[model samples]
Target: MLYIIQTTLTLGFVYSLVALALFISYRILDIADLTTDGCYVLGMAVSVTAAYYGHPIFGIFLAIIAGMAAGYCTAFLQTRMGVPSILAGIVTNTGLYTINLMVMGWSSNVALLKKETIFMLFKHLGIGGPWMDLAIVAVIVIGCMALLRYFLSTRLGLSIRATGDNKDMVAASSINPRFTITVGLVIANALTGLCGALVGQLQKSADINAGTGIVVIGLACLIIGETVMNGKKNMTRNILACLIGNIIYRFIYAIILQTRLIPIDFLKLVTALIVALAIASPSLKENFSLYARRRKESL
Candidate 1:
């Protein structure tokens, strides 16, 4: 049970970065960037390759750069090439398949089981323990949250938020919605790549298929957070909600896995069902209330 809890928290914290990325693109920029799946694999590919060369730290930076580049391509397609936003993301994502394969030396998977990773660095520095993994993930998550909070308070961040709220109004204010959108996506995808890099190192392996359905998972985390933490308008609250929601989601998964009530193959389906419920919760509640009221009136 303790091990399960720790695993859940570690995974939740690591994946919260993905939720944060989607929060920026989906919640803040109002763009459903499908580049997430590709960028995630891109990050893992880059990170594992770097780690294979004995530069695990440098691998993280390279992953972020690669993610930013992917974001730029997506943004350019939408902003400069007249491609629809969704279509631009799809194009970039599709192209990234080849790019990610190339980055992995034309392989579908790479193993880092024998490699030294960022987590191993902590172990080497006399911080080794069962809690070491959780501690490392917690530090990273907190740092990201703090940095994001500070960044979102800046003038440029306000422009991004404003662009999401009302593109026409931002244009009227001379904020250049195109620029804001581009910047927002770049930052969002950078975070996504970072998440992938961390997960690759943490798991000590990188697979081409690891990023499949990542966007859906991130969106589900975002919706779950919003539903649970509803009625909060503060940015900090909202950001914290993302992390908390991820933890809650992972915890639920852990519990379910332990129960073995369902087979492993259906886990993705379970996630989809959870997301569906979270997405429809508000409407479901409203309808239930209406039905109750109607029945009461008849009584």
Candidate 2:
């Protein structure tokens, strides 16, 4: 039980980074970027393959670069080809499936058993063998959140946020909304790729399907965070919400797994339902309040 909780938190922290990427494009940019599913897998494949070649750190860097390329592809379709934003994302995502396969060098996947990964560095530093993975992941999560918070406070960062808010207004200010969107996508995808690499390293394998429905999972995290943190527009609150929501989401998943009633095959469906409920909760609450008010008026 304790080990399960630890595993959940470790995996959850890596996933929270992906969720943060979703938050940047979805909530901040108001764009539905579906490239997450493929880019995530691409990251894992790139890193694991690189590790197989005995360049583990370089593998991580390659994954980030690959993610950035995926981001650029999506932005290019939207900005240069004049495709709809969502459609552009879909196109990039479709292309990435092939790209990921190529990165794996015609292999279906890669497994890095007995790998010397970032987690190993924690152990080398005397962080304790049993707790090393969790400790490393926790440090990475905190570092990312802090870096993102600082970036969002910068002038360019403010412009990016503004672009998400109102593209036309940002354009009117001569900020070039397309540039902002492109940069935002690049940053989001880069973080997501790093997450994938780290997670693959932790798990000791990278499967082509590892990133299936990743966008949905990220959305679930974002919604859960927003609900728990009340969706405050402030930077600090929003970042903190992502962290808290990630921990809670992992705990919920752990609980569900413990229940013998839910088969492993049904897990995806249950997760989807949970995400749907989280997304609808605010509207449901509003409707209930309106109903109570109507009853009072009638009385």
Best-performing candidate as measured by lDDT: 1
Please, what is the whole-model Cα lDDT of each candidate in the order they appear? 0.90, 0.86
> How displaced is residue 189 in candidate 1, in Å?
0.4
Candidate 2 residue lDDT tens string, 1-299: 88998888887888998888988888889999999999999999998988877787888899999899999999988988899999998999998888888888877888887777766766777767787888878888899999999999898899999998876687678888878899999999998898888888888788989988888888888778878898766988888877778888888778777885677678778778888887788799999999999999999
TM per prediction? 0.94, 0.92
> What tens digits encode model 1's per-residue C-alpha lDDT throughout 201-266?
988888999998888888888888877888248899889888988998898778778887788678
Regions more than 4 Å wrong, model 2: 122-127, 281-299
